[model samples]
Target: MAELHGTTDDRNEGDASRGVDRTLSAVLASGALGHSERRAKLLRYLVARETSGEGDKIKAYAIALDVFGRDETFDPNSDSIVRVEVGRLRDGLRIFYGECTDPDLWTIDIPKGTYRPTLTPPRVEPVSPPQPAHLNRWALIILPILVVLPLLYYAMRPAPAPEPTAPYPVLRIAVMPFEAAGDHPNLEKVAFGLYTELSLDLSAYPWIAVVSPLDPNEIGADYALKSQLLWQGDNLQTNSQLISLPEERLVWSKSYSIPTTVEHIQDTQLQITSGIATSLGSENSISPDLIVARNARNSKPNLEGFLCFISTYRYAVEPTRTEHLRLRNCLEDAVDAFPEFGEAWAALGVLYMDEVRFGRNPRPGHDSWAEARAAIDKSLELAPLRNAPLMAGVVLSVQAPVQDLERARQLGRKLMELFPRHPPTLALIGSLISEFDGRWPEGHDLVQQAIALENAPPSGFFITPAFFAALQEDDAAALAATAPLTTRTSETELLLKYLAAARNGKTEMMAEQRVLLAQKDLSSDADLVEFVKNRRFHEELEASLTSQLEAAFLVKADE
Candidate 1:
């Protein structure tokens, strides 16, 4: 009759007699079952079957009939009534256990992917007080001195008149998260990438200070910058706004459509950056001479293939059938337009590899894998170790169905040696691959260095640290890293909250997350996981990492 698994029993008549009474009493009187009659009936049915070791027979069809009055001929696939009610039963158990304060109580749960009910006895770790008496004593002695010294110093100083504030408040501009126009995960990445690029570009002006990625509406900044990113037809459309927060009006707004070919990407970016800086009317405006000088360094700003390559590069970040087909077609046209463009060929190769990895083919059994190899080889032949080809080749090394981790590592080292002023995007992707490959310490340091080198990393960059904290099982660190992320809502944000809440045993806090996750209209759990982890493409990448680990172990053994 005892709820705990290791309860004392003679394993004879005494045990047999007690179990019958215990099972019945636990089922009929349990708080989890005391609520809705239907839920109670379902719980009793599941629990009774489980205790008698016939739990396997209590599948969805059986439960539908016995608990919900479904006919024997009921089809669970067509009728979601059983699924819906079972979900409530799970929530009911959670609610029951959440309200119970007893530390030693055994709670019932129906874990995901199964119908069996489990009785779990609470296992509590005993808390201990801090034992470092020396540090505690030092804090007591220094606390008063630290407080009084500041007060005494202030009292002896003469107060001066406050300085006049600037009329425009130095044009403090806060960049809100760029809105992604689609539900696709790839679009989210593209939006975030653009957001980071714009923030970094704008921050170059001495008069502007980019606010942290919090809600712009709540901030008291002089100006607020916001953007909406969309991929429609053959162009990347960005609707940007510079708002005067004090006046509560839009100061400047422009909608730009950059061709997917990306020929004028740098020019478009430069224009937006300079436009905002010039419009601010600050003394430290960017010099027109410098803009001209910067443009002069861009060798082929009007190149047809490179512009298309830019859009293709961003599109492949997280790909789908319709978009990737368009991407591949665009890449083909780019190559045909500029046959000598090595980067275009490399891009075409990467696209084919990714399409194969995603199980999408332009044509059935087209042998894209072979085409990918040939195209990549030809690209390297045309522009060996050149910046454009090298960048494209490195991404292929990391992302293709057959990852060349050695090549990726070499490229990463070579990139650092070359010392690009800003290579944070590559650093970010490498860090992701490191983490995915279970090299957590390496990944953590790589991301740390990347963030330190660039002040305005992509908005999604925050997830790296949160993920690191989660892997280390450091709940407090995870919570702190995720605290700044409360200004937005996404599946990623929700999953992070759920993780942090679960680690702290905040079941009440998890209630909303549970509801949101289980909403009927929410996408499938698998898709949500993929979106959160940024694994929209190359679905089997992580699975391959497992084999990589095994191969690594074998190499270590041989060594």
Candidate 2:
């Protein structure tokens, strides 16, 4: 066995500085070249490459193969050998960085597609200091579960039933984006599909509240009565999203990047959903009827119906009409096969809402609002506390009579109370507070949290956070917050920085922004809004800034 060794003098160094040395030492000791004589040769290769800054996977592999020459070609197919050794190396590097004392020392990261080391500056630690006291208390409390039988018993005890007279508030939950596996072309679709299915499955639990992803308008709301779930792909090859509710900490996380068959997907879904149900302290399992409802054929008709429903509910954002029609037809077929399906009925109602919202004419003699009301009513009749009816209630509140608003508000509050951390509920409540109640700060916080939970790697929901921050007149905060997003462009950042400067009364910042914006040819309101939102600036600022820019440009154009 290779002995792990480190210099004692390194411990006396500051954390950052020590970390760098430890990392370098670990890399040297990784035994990458081979097990015997080749180990020294590998080290030499690494040293040479590091010194020259020209290390790569091919070179590393070639060196390793050469060292083991004629005995056996370096077997790249040996999963166990590669994984175990690489894992050890990774652990060593982690420990080195984690214990480093100096913040300025550059660290080496092994990038994919090459064995070469890439030198990068250390990550900036978040400004918030650790809650040592709280963490210590938690650690102490968690320790000794094995010896403390009574505490273990108490910890494992089922939650007591609520009193009959006491109203049980509806639970609300947010399902973060799920991580995908590998470079699959349909990775996004898979994540979205999982999200949709999980949302549907959870919707069936009467005691558990479910939130839809359709409502992006209400992202920030009170976090007093919610829980969050984070979903991600293992090994960063798949998809992942984090979920958090107000007041409550994270309750569940899942990664699904391992190679899986169809059965595995179903079983994993069941296990995860079951875990979530348990976390919510649900006494009852999902209804067998709901399970049966999911068994319909994956035909075009079913797909169309789902599409129509989604299109209607998401009409405000204007999804592609081609996709919308395709989904609508699929769902319609689903309904045709299962006329008694409560979810189908509820979705049909949402589809009708879409038609009205988008001004799409229905087949002869179909009244969109009337059909919507009927479908929702049927869904409620079938599954009173299920997610579909709850969603229908939300839709009704927006489209129905003033009296229905009270019912919608009541249902909304109930859903929020049950699933307080749910993204859709947060978004809904935030929207209500912003548009109806004029509680901007409260609404802003809710929306911000929701966006954090849903936005993924390549395509993020940027506008919501930017607009909310803009409302607060905190452009600098918005710019700083959005600086790390991979999907946003430099021009977008520059525009936001300019807006922040304008809001902060800094003309120099605005001048810098103008140059970048001009260079990028992104002078339109749409472009400005995209940049502002990506930076979490206010949406209204787009028009206001455009006017200012046009006036400024006119002066320049004349001069």
Q: Worst ten-residue run, lDDT, model 2?
A: 1-10
Ten residues in a row with the worst lDDT in model 1? 290-299
Over the full model, what C-alpha lDDT does candidate 1 score relative to the true structure? 0.57
How high a TM-score does candidate 1 get? 0.39
- How do the predictions measure up, each by TM-score? 0.39, 0.39
Deviation in angstroms for 467 in model 1? Answer: 3.3
Model 2 lDDT per residue over 415-459, tens place: 665444445656666655443444666765565445433322122
Clashes of 1: 5
Model 1 residue 84 lDDT score: 48
Predicted model with the maximum lDDT: 1
For every model in order, what is the number of clashing pairs?
5, 60
lDDT of each: 0.57, 0.47
lDDT tens string, model 1, 3-93?
A: 3332333345454545444544544454333223565677778777865667668789988888877898899756655654565456446
